[model samples]
Target: MSSTISRSLAGRKARRRRSRVHSLAIDGNDCMRQDNIVVEIPTSTARAATMTSSSDPIPSLGQHVDFRQRFEEEINTFATSLVHREPKYVPSHQEDALAMARIDSSCETAIDHWMLAQSFGCVKATDLTEGAIELCQLLVGVDGCEETRKVLETLSAHESVSPKNFLRGLCAGAITRWVYLDTKPQLPSVCQYPQSDVLRSVLAATPNIYRRLVDAMTLEYLERHFATTIPALSKELTKRLHTILTNFRGLKSANTLTDLSDHINNFRVWERYMADAFEGALRLRLNHLRSPMKYNYTFPSSGQPFVEDKMISLYSEASRRRPHQVWLCLSPLIESWNESMDSSSHVIISPARVISS
Candidate 1:
């Protein structure tokens, strides 16, 4: 079976970026889990207090409830163009209802979502660092919005929504329920059984940083550089791998030029030993399958600022020293492939292409 991943550099383009979060370390997939914290909203004692007195000034009497159709007509006429995201739904005749609406169930939530959406600060499709804070606010807002937020918070808490995407893979409805659908994973080339497809989806949604960290933990990066080799893979494992590769193919970063260089350099080395070991192990372990192979890669002595081998080794060394980053063991499945007739046979780990902004 062919396992070559395509790396097309013909259409390269540059984008602008400003960096934050100094020195990012792969904090393992599970570290970012947002579980174990309970956000409680205080009960509405204000309403109870207001109506507590039996000696209320006014006599108890029924108030007129207006007809819906007539009232809606007035409200529509009085509506402003600014209502596109107008804070609340206002009905003119029921000034009382409009007044009540003004008092946000979770005034904080509406404002937070609005600010992020307006400022464009909270629209990250891949990373959830900014979005999670916004999500937490909306999920535990007060008043009528309380119930809805409570429900989502319960689910998020139960699912253990991680600031990291590692736990996200464990959730079944992340793309549909949490993130936008455009970022969902798919079979880049072919379809598979429902159960297998589900597994692929989970892996696809998972954060690669954590995935690599997991591998580093289990495989212990530097213990053995990836030997030039080949391996055979089961059809089931291949499908799961294909899904991961496809997802990573579109991964983009909001890092600066220098940051991107550092990360890319780290990955370049990661590819060497990690890729080699993964390929070597798979080939040696599953030679019984139909085909296995390895690729011949030669990097220029002074291509860019980053040396591929050195960065890979450095990342491994740092990863091993830290204890929380053990998830590297769950690295992607390696599949051997044929790059070209003249080129040596290669083991394909993924189709990851880092996009910089």
Candidate 2:
């Protein structure tokens, strides 16, 4: 298995080397293009309000109703655009719908997504700071866009005051959700996931400034999350790790960086241990065969027309498994479980089987 993975890695490296020349252009991936980006323009509230309502002296009931409906509709449209950051669908007229259709230029869209989320108070300043830092690094890497260089410089200054951008980048890179996939532990491979791939490349290629920024942001993040939780009184007199990590004073900040790195290493070790333990448990626990629902065992279920239905049923557990089949196949069959009482009610859906079998 190690050999196989190594060979795969080698092949990927070879391919990347071949394409390196072609990829020299800044913003090589269309995904990072920032051209034609649209920002959320704050319009005058008075103009919008006037357009929605009417100035009338004791308006008739029909006019009042029409005005009220139009006003509500306009409000809904504005709210929808702000919330979703996309053009809303209009069901009334095809012409109106066609007119609303806007070409989504990629560069413009990426910036818009990042900026629009920040404008409506959906994202915190810290979060924006983190994003801007990442954008700056990205722009520096691409090295082609003069416009992006200016933006990066501006963001760099802002990042010093607020560690938000740095925080955001650290969170996405470290606290990832793609740990396990389909009841199986995922291999630590950038090629397997887009997020991992980008993160690996960025860290490898970024300047020392960004690297130091990452370390600083991570230390601050650890301080915020863990510093206050540890109790002061302790008989062992070993140390309050969180406090030591957070404190920047002579006694406190001295070993803070090393302490944080140790904590992070410990967490990584724990994650690996847990993954291995789970895999072992899955292989050895045959009692899980009878408790399919508990383990989330799933299998293809029969549907209408017999042949057409390929959906896997969560409620119904497969009675038998092939000799070579792993326990992961017998675990919970559904992607996500519904919380309804009907779905939650436990019944002897699958026949009980011997654990030894």
Candidate 3:
């Protein structure tokens, strides 16, 4: 009888569990279907004991609360921890320190201060140095002061000084002397030989100044000046030519003439003489090399030949005096001159015949 009673109680408990599961499923289904409706889920411990945990089709919306504030607080705490953390150590570079010290110490003088400002502001140190050198050269070339001369002398004396530095000094010295001491209105005097001793000193000190001078030379003004000062130039030209010719006679070698002609041709000062009209002096020098006999015979037969005899050619003797290679290059030019002369003579002779008739 006791066994039967226990069995009845067990059957009752099983029925109750089934009933609770059924009720919970019904509530979950209703909550899922009506999203706007807030289902009151009973928070009783007896009800929780009867319900089994499951992946619900829909969770309770009424019980749901935002975790954004909690997440933001956690993030704030993490950021604050990072902010309060010890800073990393970066060691200073020695080169940077040295460069800053050098810049601070080296910048002196008005020009140096200006250069430093430019270097710090917009320009590089190398660029500033180059620009300063260029400006200094220009200033010296136009008109150098005593201070500039001393600066140049100091720079030139330094074994480590650059070509630009020495050039700046040289240009200043040359220009200063030309403007102040050798103010001859004659172009040849100014261009050819201006205060030779002083000019020589500058050039000797800086052998690289030749190219800069040539590039900067004004050819048009030089040509204009040449036209006005031919008389003064003629005397100088004659003196130099005589010296060259005497040297050529002593050498008795055509190579001497070729070397001299090359020197004269390459000379920037005598560039104006390369024109067809003024090529007489150079041609005459070449002619002497090609036919020394012409000069030798003329000196004894007639008086010392004048510059007017520059074109006087002895075709037979021309080939005899120089080697074939030396005269070969000049053959075409000689032939062209010969043809022109023949045509000119024919025109003259025809006009004379008409008058006679």
lDDT of each: 0.27, 0.29, 0.30
RMSD of 2: 36.4
Which 10 residues in a row give candidate 2 its minimum summed lDDT? 171-180
Instruction: Report the number of the highest-TM-score candidate.
Output: 1
Off by over 4 Å in 1: 1-254, 287-357
Residue 326's lDDT within candidate 1 is 15
**Model 3 local distance difference test score:** 0.30
Backbone collision count in every prediction?
15, 14, 0
lDDT of 3 at 327: 10
Tens digit per residue, CA lDDT, model 3, 202-233: 45554444322322232323434433454454
161-198 per-residue lDDT for model 2 (tens digits)? 12333222221111111111222322234344333443
User: Every model's Cα RMSD, please?
Assistant: 39.7, 36.4, 35.9
Clashing pairs in 3: none
TM-score of 1: 0.18
- The TM-score-based order of candidates, best leading, equals 1, 2, 3
User: Which model scores highest in lDDT?
Assistant: 3
- Candidate 3 has what TM-score? 0.14
- TM-score of each candidate? 0.18, 0.17, 0.14
Please provide, for model 1 over 174-237, each residue's C-alpha lDDT reduced to its tens digit, 9 standing for 90 to 100.
Answer: 2112221221222222133223453344346544422332322223211122112122222222
